[model samples]
Target: MSAALSVINLAVLARRLHDTSLLPALTPVSVGTLVYPAPTSTVEINPNWEVLYWNTSVYGVVDNSVILECGTTLPDLYIWSFTQPGTEAIKAVVYNLGRGPKIQKIAKTLGQLTIVLKSADVSIEKLLLAANGLFTCQAFYNIDEDPKVHYYYVHLTVRVPVSKPNLLMTGTPVEGSKLWMHCSVDNGTGPIKYIWKHETQNENITNLNESNSVIYVDDVKRNYTGWYHCVVSNAVNTESSDKVWLDIKFGPDDPQIDVSPKTTSEWGYTILETQNVSLLCQAMSNPPSQYLWFYNNFQINIGPKLTITRILRNGTGNYSCSAQNSYLNTSSSRTISLTVYFGPDNPQIDVSSNTVMDRIYTAVEPENGYVALETQGVSLLCQAQSNPPGHFIWFFNNSQVHTGSQLTIPKIHRNQSGNYTCSAQNTYLNSSSSRTIHLTVYCECHLQQY
Candidate 1:
């Protein structure tokens, strides 16, 4: 029994005995022990058998109501006492004896008070931090003057909800620099946890969990630009702060060019002199990238777009686009190739004949050339220059005889010698040019040297 509890029992005994003079001298004694100094009158007092001490702790939020329960049944006489470090007080009483429930000692700061008789519990409304302490409910059961003490004790702790956090950026963020952010709240209880969220420009979401309120981006990157928010949570409630945009200054990523009138040939993009061509460049950057175009590795234009009214052969080369971020002094480039194509111009036919007479007898001849004898071997080639080398087809006496650039005759006969025509075709341009040559077989018997 604490000194406070001893005082509680002394008051209960004085109330039950109507006559204050018959009460024995109050002596501080441990709970469950009775000290009797011989009652002056014949009136006798029954001793309390037990002193119940409750060790339960109650949790509550500020401005909320909590109950201090005293078992299930109401006692004949009960008194509630509180013990705090500095502010020791007790309230929450209703229907004491004959009087209607009269609340006592509770100020407006302590909130409202109500008593629940059916459960023998005291409800403390509008609770504050000042109410944080030990509450003892001393109840006397039965109508007897029995001094039995039923003590219901409660230890209360008050909490407050977390407030919205304020997110602060430590400094201006730049690419490759350290980025620091701090989250703080104006009002909140201790043990508050914070969480940070990052939502990118592309709608990608990332969550970082931390016990700390401060966060750091060791290496700030372009992709780190996004909306950031901090979530604050305590035991009572959770709140989120307003979002802050983190825009990081970065470089112009590698440039990519899109070519219009896109046709693929041995030359990257093929077009004719009469056709129009367009080239477009694009890059990912923070402040938008400026572009410069290069034709055959030479500066030719500027901006993201370039158009050719009429493409010529001289424009056929590696076209490059340089993307630059002037603020960061960084640049990136990409190159594409283009070609201006024309027709497979007038093709020429050359004939080479071989004779056994000298074993190495050779001469380059044109149309109407002779093969010497019936056993002479001859070969004819059709040559042309075009954007994409032309496909070739050959004809002997106006009829298709072979395909490709060359035609060969292993043994030449007098009847077999005739007009051999070669046609070069540019499949891409749908154009053709042809040239013809004739070979005649001459025998030694018909010598003109006689």
Candidate 2:
């Protein structure tokens, strides 16, 4: 009867097998059919799939004898005697899609029925449900009594991008001097924010966190001098930078004084004679001013023209000028009233000749120590008178002899004797006198009697 309907269709396919939602289902069951002394059937497989094929059909009609083997021709055929041994389970789940739950989980171990998914959640159905990958597997053996099933599918793709915030300027801005602004974000994910702007203060705003980037201004005025920017956010992305302008340059101002012959003369009129005079000082700023000159009130080291080489009469009083820069300072002209002039009042020295016993008996005249005679004899004359002309010097015993106004000893020998002294020099008096003349030498001796 067709072999009892193939044994009731193999017992209803093994009672409709069961894989629940452990996915992947493949079942094939048929036992003891082709009747022929049958009593050698075995099939077992639960090591997930490995048992290619096994077939048999034997009948006794005229030529019927079939058998296929693998399992080493099954001695007593025992591959666990027919399935049931597969239970090494592991499960993990984490999902925070609406950005609220905050998920985290980790577990490891792979071998035998291997399933490895370290570091998951790169989206894509959470990495195929944590690598159970829509499951599929099968294996049946009985020395290959025909049983096999294996199928797998896992697909995933994910990418993330949203992080950009940086604006810096902690230094380099001095217009009125004092500025700082910095904002950064390399990581601290999402919901971040900071804003500091100035395009000339548009309602001036400043709100920063994440341990602040920096924003300090002690004093920087001049309307805080223009352009300075910063705006960084996170709710996805936002950044702006490129605006910093501060120009500061300081100067030299506050200086004044100018005078040149602004006259008021008295000690001898006009060009303030008796010598040297120069007075002038001009200072005007914007970074160009520095001049100081004073006379009568001291401080006037000469140069910048306030010179008075010899403008005597006590350099004729009051003269002032001062101008400075680096912030306010002024003093100019008027204080001057200088006048000096005079002549011919420095001279007085006269020596009528020498006598202190002729300077104790003159002699020592070697070219100019007085006593020099030979042009009509008694030489010793020293006169220095001034208002202008004065200089005459002659000293015999005590050195120095002969220098102007008069000192002439001509034709007076006997070594011209010594000690005569006379000196007079003027620019302002110096006079001396001494005289001694005992010099007599007349040669005319002739005695030849032997």
Q: Taking the tens digit of each residue's C-alpha lDDT, what string does model 1 give over 245-275?
A: 9989877888888989888865477778668
RMSD of each: 9.5, 24.3
Provide the overall lDDT of each model, using Cα atoms, as 2-decimal numbers.
Answer: 0.71, 0.38
- Residues forming the 10-long window of minimal summed lDDT in candidate 1: 30-39
TM-score per prediction, in order, is 0.62, 0.22
Off by over 4 Å in 2: 1-17, 21-178, 182-212, 215-240, 249-450
lDDT accuracy of residue 7 in candidate 1? 50
Candidate 1, overall lDDT?
0.71
